[model samples]
Target: MERSPSAQADLRGGVIWIALGAGIAVLSWRMDRLEHMHVNPYTVPGLVPGLLGAGLVVLGALLAWRTIHGGALARVAAPVGVDRIGDFRVVATGALCILYATLLIGHLPFWLATTIFVFVFTAAFDYKERRTAGTLARGLVVALIAAAATAAAVSLVFEDLFLVRLP
Candidate 1:
């Protein structure tokens, strides 16, 4: 039976996720073990990433299975309307991610880069809605707080707690 376009897209996404996760697991597993330092097994560099990769694999498998054998595959629904605004948002988000990775990482400290990215991302997405409601300032304040909190948490957790150096 022919699957809907959304189901097909889900299947493709699931496959991609599985592939990406498998790659991450493999690479992470091959990372330095620090045998000389005799680090605890739980503290191995690959431990967390390997778990995350495994999680992705499991989730991807579920997505693919659902797409293949669940209601999405069984139904014969009409084509859904496409939202151009949603598409624009996706493109805009992707552009922001690209900018963060390419331009922000090396030039700025991790916390600062993260702060800017999160703030811009939040503000950019919420600007129109907040402006329409005449609450742009409040939205900006909220976004800034969220951005600062995220940056601080990430920096503290990774650098101070986990001892992982940030770029």
Candidate 2:
């Protein structure tokens, strides 16, 4: 009658995903419809985001349902520490996102802002592992390459391919 840690974790994760997805969906729906631009109906700015949010909602619901059907709530088990992404990581990630969106995006060239954000974020989260392995320098190099590539790719897709202006 007791569920394992994985089951409990799944349930919690599913709920979190559901909540996050719903938030995204609502925000996406509220995004400007570009009525003035008279853009193609299919190219509405929020279409992709709304679809992504809907998918997330569906997947999260499935995860929650599966966990419940598997007897996660049959009986409560003693709380055990779940080795999930720690609270600090979550907070740091949120802070970095806010900084990138607010300070980096509009103030700097899109590519430059993205490059800096990605590099800093990657280096910050990856340093501890690299330090233990005595590869901090290599990690930094890798992070730089990754950041550049990410920026280039995003810029190309959004600006060139999608023809969307970047702030």
lDDT of 1 by residue, 1-167 (tens): 24346876788888989998898889889999888999887799998898898889889988998888866657675567677787799899999999999999889999899999999999999999999999999999999999999999999999999999888
Clashing pairs in 1: none
Clashing pairs in 2: none
Number of clashing residue pairs in every model?
Answer: 0, 0
Could you tell me the TM-score of candidate 2? 0.51
C-alpha lDDT score of every prediction, in listed order: 0.89, 0.91
Which is the leading candidate under TM-score?
A: 1
